[model samples]
Target: MSKEAIVARIEKKPLSMTINGKKIGPIDVPVGMPMIDFLHHYLNLTGTHFGCGEGVCHACTVVEVKSDGSMVDTRTCIANAHSFDGKTIITIEGQAKTDASGNVTQLTPIQTAFIEKFSFQCGYCTSGFIAGATAFIDRLKREPVKRADLETAIEEALNDHICRCTGYVRYYEAVRDVALATPGCVIGQEDKR
Candidate 1:
């Protein structure tokens, strides 16, 4: 076989998904293209930071809403764009409500808490932290953790995420505050009543 015949051509596939509450794609994407590149190059949603690119830093995290409505933190740096086909994903930009003018009208509790607590320094990892924490909060709403387990729960939820600045305390504290403030996130409170 000639060298030209030995080299395989890159295949393109139609990719479509709902991102940040908007339906996007069915556009042709090269197979094996990372989701981060798809989000940045095709959709222009730059809020999902590309950190380690190896999927270890968690800075590329986005929330994938499952069919049952449960959310999971998904890493875009390593996952192929086609892997998200037909899925519902929420990036950091989607966490805030916007007006017709594209101005942010309201930030989700998790986002607000992160800002208030100064949970990030350079802010590169902030998006992933927000996405992970938001998913944790959503889970807590469905299945409240015992008050005694709140600390452990928070740690477990965010353990995989890495932040180079601000240590991990502020992020944990911010999520803790949000979970505690949100009604039904903790279970033991009812026993006290």
Candidate 2:
């Protein structure tokens, strides 16, 4: 096929989604374009880092809040932009509250814990860590884990993320601290007994 014909065959679709509590698009996006590109190039929501481009590193993770109000971490590197149609997603940008002037007024406990614990070095993977940890914490709110299982749960939830800076200890520790501090994230000792 000729280059012109192939170029003409490229498909475009209208994409729309709720991102970070804000409605975005009805914008035309090329089919098969990665969600990461849509976020960075079209919307300029660059906090979702495109690390490793292949979805293995998971530095491009975002939280997709399902219709049932459960959140799942989604990797944007390989997922098509069209796949997120009408979905509600939260990027790293949405983790904190901002004042009317757009200045951040409060950080989510997970975010504050990550900072207080110094959970990252280069910070490239920090967004993914935050998204994953936040979702895990939210899940705990709905289904509290046994106190004894908290550590293993933390490890399981965050184990897939690859941090080149070797900040795993701090990251895991931060999440553990948040889980313990947040009421209902872990079952009470009395309940365990």
Candidate 3:
């Protein structure tokens, strides 16, 4: 069966949104433009990445902050700029805490764990991993996972992302370590060991 169908092209217009807490746009942007391009070319946020144009690779994942302050991972490659018209997003650039003068004060614990565990190789997938980990950890706060199920939970969170360098064990260990070390973050039965 032929799957070709013609859809009317939407007119391009200016796009403006708050990115990493900064106002951007009122600048011209076309409708249907991939957000990865906008972030890289328009905003110079190369950290969001562009591994596969398709969302399957998971390397271009970004966190979308909802109106209620909850977050979810979104694939920028499959999403358009207008999809984020009134939304807040956290990219790799915004992962660290800033000091009074705007200098980076500290890295998020996940990033720190990655550094401690050496969780990346070429680092193309680091941003995606970090974004996913952030989402996962945030979820644990609301709905904690069992101790025995911790590995599975971490796997489910990060298994989709493709890493050409690391075989993923290190990444898994890093996320798990953070969860375990964070103190009362993930709810579970007491360890019997």
Candidate 4:
């Protein structure tokens, strides 16, 4: 389609979805608008970063809860907000654990690891990393990683992310540490955590 044709098709509609455990919207938004824009401008949840504005960088990663209750990381920059209407989204803000009394208690393991390992520099990519890491750790919990394939598993999980600063080693180390610390997740694991 021509640029003008695509531009002419930009639409507006009410958006409704579950964000962080809260019900949001039935709010109006442009149909073709990027999910990142809706997140920042409409919802005022700005933690999801805007990096390349293209899908090349995973800085805008958000966890999409599938119908089967499985989760995966998705890029928002290249996706239309309307496509997420019925889906449950977990952004960086949702990654934190909440207490029984509805108060937020502690950060998720990935967030804690990031701080401990000093994995981020400017922190623009930290949100995305958290999302990806959460998904990775969750996946391991569901389908445990074999010890023999531990390194490859971690690499495959995080390879999609792009971090501009603080060197990649720290981020990888943090993930490995978290994985090793979790029991029954990493098969035949040593206590590297």
Candidate 5:
């Protein structure tokens, strides 16, 4: 039940799998290696930005599936390399591609919405927000959301990423706009004061 004991028990194992459609893990890597290092150094998925390595900034947030079939956010900066044994993950790079059908493929509606609305200032947090919010919006699509409800949802979705460039308003606006613009989940036009 101790960290040293557990690590010593599995010191010689490696992990590998498909990430954003590319194969990773199943290869030899050091025990307790951080996922961020593997992503940025080995596989080159730079879209997963890192703001704070302590997991408080949420900038490195990526979606991965748990064994229970539940999707959750994990901080790549501190996540152990071997923890990703057999799970599917979606990172910022995964959302940047499009399809040959000319339908704006991999970039989710929420990401497109962020671009259309200029939802970022320094742009450091956009990737995290995009990945996090798109997943949130996808779930919202399964239900009904109104204008006010949309604002609350966007606010809740981006409660982590810190923006010192004073672009928070625009970021929130962009997400709300995307949710509303999305068919069947629209927030009414903002009231001009």
Candidate 6:
């Protein structure tokens, strides 16, 4: 890659954020680059993967606020940086916990679930699946999800991602585990198959 040109100078603007539990800054960043590039190149938050630059792959998924109060997985690879100007964005880096005693702790329940289920092989697609699964679990938390609904949610969430390794069955299992672990959210109906 080339430095190209400093077409623009990023200002020291305020960007208040509370990632995980810590309040991250009010930092300055280039205004035009995509959020994924900024996160990887600038912030060094590389866990967010990129498969398709055209936004078809959920490999670059990150949680963001929708027009409504709910949160949805948005493709960071294609999302503009300035669009997140004031909103709180959560990347894979923001999903884990940090100890007050100065030690980084174990992975969150969602992360642990992925590992326990052996959700991925190459690991390229793991983070995005984690992000999407987090949202899916959150959605299930609010209501009683049926078997079909659980499958539907998993299908919709995983549809945008292309995993060349570890066929999607494991990913589905991860989501299923999270859903089943959450009370009242398990696939309740009989297997139609």
- Which candidate has the top score in TM-score? 2
* Each prediction's TM-score versus the true structure: 0.92, 0.93, 0.87, 0.88, 0.77, 0.80
Name the weakest run of 10 consecutive residues (lDDT summed) in model 3: 1-10
Residue ranges of candidate 1 with Cα displaced over 4 Å: 1-9, 190-193
Residue 44, model 2: lDDT of 89
lDDT (10s digit) by residue, model 1, range 102-166: 89999999989988888889998999999999999999999999988888999999999999885
Q: After TM-score superposition, what is the CA distance of residue 82 in candidate 5 from its true location, in Å?
A: 1.6
Angstrom error of the Cα, residue 150, model 3: value is: 0.8
**9: Cα error in model 6, Å:** 6.9
Give the true-structure RMSD of model 2. Answer: 2.9
lDDT of each: 0.92, 0.93, 0.85, 0.86, 0.72, 0.73
lDDT of 1 at 51: 95
Poorly placed runs, candidate 5 (over 4 Å):
1-12, 65-71, 98-106, 184-193
Q: Write the per-residue lDDT of candidate 6 for residues 144-186, one digit (tens) a residue.
A: 5787677777887677777889569878877777676677665
Alpha-carbon runs more than 4 Å astray in model 6:
1-18, 22-25, 65-69, 100-103, 187-193
Worst 10 residues of 6 by lDDT: 1-10
Candidate 4 ranges beyond 4 A from true positions: 1-10, 98-104
| Lowest-sum lDDT 10-residue window in model 4 | 184-193
Residue range 21-94, candidate 3, lDDT tens digits: 87777777778899898899888899998988999878999887788787788889988987788678999998
lDDT of prediction 6: 0.73
Q: How would you encode candidate 5's per-residue C-alpha lDDT over 1-193 as one tens digit per residue?
A: 9999886777556787668766675787777778888788778778788788888887888877555545566778888877887767878777667575634456666677777777787788777777677666665666556665766776777787777676778778777666666676553545421
lDDT of 2 by residue, 1-193 (tens): 9999998899999999999999998999999999999999999899999999888998999999999999989999999999999999999998899988989999999999999999999999999999999899989999999888988899999999999989999999999888888898898644321
User: Which candidate tops lDDT?
Assistant: 2
Residue range 3-73, candidate 4, lDDT tens digits: 98986777779989888878988988876889999999988889999999988779999998888887899
Local lDDT at 143 for model 5: 59
Clashing pairs in 2: none
Model 3 lDDT on a 0 to 1 scale: 0.85
